[model samples]
Target: MNNIVSMAWVKEHMGEPNVVIADCRFVLGKPDAGREAYEASHIPGAVYLDLEKDLSAPVDEHGGRHPLPDIFDLTVALSLAGIGNETKVVAYDDQGGAMASRLWWLLKYLGHEHVYVMDQGFAAWTSAGHPVTDEIAEPTPVKFLAIVEHTMLVEMDQVQELLGREGVTLIDSRETPRYRGEVEPIDRVAGHIPGAINRFWKDGLTVTGSWKVADEQAERFADLDKNRELIVYCGSGVTATPNVIALQEAGFTNVKLYAGSWSDWISYSENPVATGDEENA
Candidate 1:
């Protein structure tokens, strides 16, 4: 199934027995903003999922700022959101799919294959004259068992081992400045992982802010070998997911996410960092 769905498709499938819409809007610094937006107005029958609470675990010294949520806890959250094993979930956010793609990646990592990210997000949905509701949805709770796709993730240690390895490509999905080590805003270290290439996640979108078509996505990464293993990462692992999805859309089958990402990479002072567009050996 395609990783992204359109607003019309979501609108068409609303209230279906097996279809669930999730409001995943989140502001990085404002913890409660997403829920507040949802409470103010959202797609009818949509359930809210917080990026920090439902999608990620508490931050620690080693793991990235947004560590993957505990599998058991995440499963329970999904169950409470009325997402069964067979449910078709559509996730959306106002942050250019950054927040929603995190949930999409998490669900896929948990072995759920029927999930998708909605295109253009909540703002487009609202601006296009779609129905919105202040009333919260009360979905019937159901069991959501996680099978766990371990192959989808790569830890910091695994990332270290893959450095400079042939047939493997580490992609830094942050902006050019961050990748080049020209500025350090969020993390202590500014440079990217040694031997990694830059592929800003936002480039996957069109000028109008919609996800690019598969052909367009393929064009975006035309220089890379599709057969090679592509491992993607961002500041805290949240933004890298869109690049993961973009790679999949571009017909790359072998892709993985470095869940700990740059934040975790920088935690160990011994880890080497590269700067200024140099893919250090």
Candidate 2:
């Protein structure tokens, strides 16, 4: 149930009778490449979750890339994966908690509390000499009941209210270029929300592309009081989950994801955007 499970911890837990391993490897370029990799070879008993097909709703330019899947649809997908209320879900991918965190946040959004994202993802697992198999896992249906927690998500209105409240820390998890409005490769807009601090999500990872130590990560987010509420946002809410996971791992007891993120914020005519590296607000 911890926000981030290190590669070592996952190796120890592999093949445990109660744990469910999910391969969430995804490539934005070849979108279907993740499923292909999963089919080629994955951890034994691991289930493949397609980010485009299984994890996201239909994409349009307006929806931003990898928009969230319907809540009920994702619930059905989890249920079909043999992930019941009691299952300890372990999600991982080649990318450092990028695609993997999507599944992690999805589980939390759906109110399943026993899920963890594998730090460093499958690459670390394979490099650690862990076992892998190509054989498919047969379906075993399980009961997954969602107790949705609305507070986990913050909408534009909620963000407005939080800005009015003093000492609110809003973090933008995009790269510095995107955060500075220097270059926008994905979304139509270039700038970030006014008054948000730039904390590139990659900063949470080491040069090896694995998550940093808990103490180090805690230090990165130490500017915000752990007890006070913090809001994390990124391009379309997909990438920000890593920051949320990192903050939670860092001992920030109260953190929420702005699911709509910069894209969603700009979608509305009223929300403000700021340019340059200077911290707003």
Candidate 3:
């Protein structure tokens, strides 16, 4: 399956045992809001997975916010949702791919190549006049074999080592204000890593809220060699996923996501921070 799926495609494949539509809806402020909304209305046979409960484990000072969930737990959750190694998973959320892309990335990390994100997310699904339901279908569980792709993830030390390095690029997926240190609403630090460049995650989306065309996405990183190592991060690692997807859609293969992101970088007082519109690296 392609990395992006449409509402029509999802509708056509709904309820198939080989397909799973995961409603990865989430609202950061109102943590339970996504689940409530999902309960109210969701795609038929769509299983709701919360960002807090299913996608992330308990965060600590060192792990930053939205730390990656335990591999065993994630495997169990996917298994309970009836997702297997062969399942073609379709994930979506209302807030672009802010929440949905995490699932997409997670599935890829677990060596599931048959995963896709519903382009434009649940809003596009509903806007297309597709069927939604309050009924929750519980499919029988199956074993999920987790083959971790360790190369796709990076820690703070590796990121630090790559700072200002010639062969790698660090892209910050936060908004312009946060990236420029103008305002920080979430983390204690208001700046970005010393060598990172700001690429707002929304830039990857079209005016209609769907992902940009392949050529448009490709143009974002046209100056860089596609094979060069690229690291993407945002405030808490969650928002950075859209950029990761954008990079993939752009045909870049050596992309890595900093799971801790800026929050983890700032957790240590000795770590450096840069503020301004200029290229810090």
Candidate 4:
């Protein structure tokens, strides 16, 4: 199945016994704003998942701003949200699919293959006259046994080892300004990891904020060799999942996420940071 699904697909399958809808809206700074918005109104039967609370672990010195949650804990949370191993999940968010993609990636990493990000997100659903409700859903929790796909993840140490190595590509998913060390509003450090190329994750979407076609996504990464290893990261790990999906859509097989990302890279004082346009570096 494709990584993205349409609003029509979601509307059709929303209430099915094996179908689960997840509302994953979140803001970067305002942690509570997502839950508030979800309470105000959301897709009927959609269970809310906060980026910081449900999707990430508590921050520490090493694991970026939003670290990957513990495997067992994450599976339990998914089970509580009515997602089982066999459930077909469709996640939607108002933030241009970033939060939704995060959930999609997490599910895939946990060896769940039937998960997708709802295209164009919640606003598009509402604009298209889909039914929504403020009443929270009470889905029956089920057992979700996770079989982690260890190959989908790349640790900081692995990333450090692969820096400047042949047949490996590190993609920094931040915007050009942040990647160039011009302005970093989030992380302490401004520059990106040394030898990492910038591939602003938002570029995977069109000007109107919808995900581009597979060919278009392919064109965006045409400069890189598809056979080589591609490791993608953002400030933390929340935003990089979209690029991971995009790369997969573009037919890249050897792709992984540097979950700690730039925030964790700078945690070690000895790690090198690079600034300015270094696409070929």
RMSD list, candidates in order: 1.2, 2.0, 1.1, 0.9
**Clashes in each model (backbone N, CA, C under 3 Å)?**
0, 0, 0, 0
Runs with alpha carbons beyond 4 Å of true place in candidate 1: 279-281
- Model 3 lDDT per residue over 1-281, tens place: 45888777888899887999999999888998999999999999999999999999998878788999999999999999999999999999999888989999999999999999888877777778889999987978999999999999999999888877887988999999999999999998899998788889999998999788778999987877776799999998888998998888889989999998999999988899999875533
Off by over 4 Å in 2: 60-63
Report model 4's TM-score to 2 decimal places: 0.98
Q: Model 3 — TM-score against the truth?
A: 0.97
Least accurate 10 contiguous residues by lDDT in model 4: 272-281
Give the Cα-based TM-score of candidate 1 against the true structure.
0.98
lDDT of 1 at 67: 93
Provide the overall lDDT of each model, using Cα atoms, as 2-decimal numbers.
0.93, 0.83, 0.90, 0.92
Candidate 1: tens digits of C-alpha lDDT, residues 89-116: 9999999999999999999998999999
User: What ranking emerges by TM-score with the best candidate at the front?
Assistant: 4, 1, 3, 2
Model with the higher lDDT, candidate 3 or 4? 4
Q: Residue 62 deviation, candidate 3, in Å? A: 1.4
TM of each candidate vs. truth: 0.98, 0.92, 0.97, 0.98
lDDT of 1: 0.93
Instruction: Report the backbone clash tally of model 2.
Output: 0
Q: Please give the lDDT score at residue 255 for candidate 4.
A: 96
**In model 2, which range of ten residues has the least summed lDDT?**
59-68
List, residue by residue over 173-204, the lDDT tens digit for candidate 4.
99999999999998888998888898989999
Reference-based lDDT, residue 208, model 2: 83
